[model samples]
Target: MSAPTLAPYVFKRPWLRNLLNPLANWYANAAGYRKLGLRADDLISEENAVVAQALKRLPMKENYDRVFRLRRAMQCSITHKLLPKSEWTKPEEDVPYLGPLIAEIEAEAKERAQLDTLTVVKNH
Candidate 1:
């Protein structure tokens, strides 16, 4: 990917960044594991569980990480067997992609909880 087109796509809304960061981080870490010559497919169970929990809380139809991975895998298999490359644009798939957003919200909630604890401590 060249810098020109990539840079434009890089600087989007902060809220989206906050939302996608966890999935992005998860992808990055998985890639890092691959770089270290480890197959991370066996590690998907834990991520799958988190993705499942997140989906219940998401109140939306799509979960990017969960759905996208499945789409990519299916596409890979199909293209290699039945489909043509010209016909498969990786299917433009996405999963709930909400893990990062939830983490951020949860962290903020935890901080507020701690602040309330301190306030109670001061009252005592």
Candidate 2:
């Protein structure tokens, strides 16, 4: 499950978004995934069932790309080296490819749960 956050609230406030944008970028850069050519979504842990399901739902090309990024990142980690600067994941390229899938899976699960417990009443 994703951590609870004020992201929605912050995003709705232009001033807050503007204030945090630079810091968020700085933090993302400092996190070092981009240095290894990994996107932000690639950092999400896949140990949970929801994430696993989401991964399975990815399109063929997207799944292949995810695996490629992961393997490349792992190789970089093993070698204790970063990818060349040119190959570092640019901010624009670091989109949340898996996040939407995860959200969809979660929404489906929630809807299923609600339906499972649904009750019907009939009038005479």
Candidate 3:
């Protein structure tokens, strides 16, 4: 698992967030997944159980689109060419669709573990 980020803590401080906002945007764009027509989440490895389950839960249309984008990115990689600027993934279009589901799954797993380890008490 990746180390927990302090991004929310930084973001909660207005001045820090203001200072970092542009830098974050610049870094995101510079990362170049957008140029390949993929969202940031698309770069996430699918080998994780949670992510794999989230992928299965995606709506058919979103799943198809995800596959299409992945294939397009793969093809671009093979050709060593980026998609045209017009075809690049737009910033507005890069929303997370599966993250919430994965979080929910993880929370459920944690809750299940807590329940499993709980000591039951019977009052006389």
Candidate 4:
């Protein structure tokens, strides 16, 4: 499950977004995933049921791409080298490919839980 976040609140305030944007960018760059040719979503652990489901639900091409990125990252890690700058994942290319799927799965689970506990009343 995703951690609770103040992202919505932070995003709603222009000043806050402006203030944090640079720091966020700097942190992302410093995280080194992009240097290894991996997107932010690639760093999400698959140990969670939600993430695992999301991964399984990924489109075939996207799944293939995710696998390729992961393997490439692993190889780079093993070799103790980063991808060339030209091939490093650009900030714009680091979108959350698996996040929406995970959200959808979580929503479905919530709905199912609600439905499972729903009570029906008899009408006179």
Tell me each candidate's RMSD, in Å, in order: 10.9, 1.1, 1.5, 1.0
Residues 40-115, candidate 2: write the lDDT tens digits: 9888888999999998999999999989999999999999999999999999998888888988988899999999
Task: Please write out the lDDT profile of model 3 over residues 20-95, one tens digit for every residue.
Answer: 8889888889999999999988888899998998899899999999999999999999999999999998878988
The TM-score between candidate 3 and the true structure equals: 0.90
TM-score, per-candidate, Cα-based: 0.33, 0.94, 0.90, 0.95
**lDDT tens per residue, model 4, 24-101:** 989999999999899999988999988988988999999999999999999999999889999999898988899888
Candidates' lDDT values, in order? 0.46, 0.92, 0.89, 0.92
Model 3 bad stretches (over 4 Å)? none
Q: Best candidate, lDDT-wise?
A: 4
Candidate ranking (TM-score, best to worst)? 4, 2, 3, 1
TM-score of candidate 4 relative to the true fold? 0.95
- Candidate 1: stretches off by over 4 Å: 1-52, 63-83, 86-96, 112-116, 119-124
Q: In model 2, state the lDDT of residue 7.
A: 87
| Residue-level lDDT tens digits of model 1 in 29-115 | 445332222233322443454434545665445444445545555665566643344433221232224645446556666889898
Clashes of each: 6, 0, 0, 0
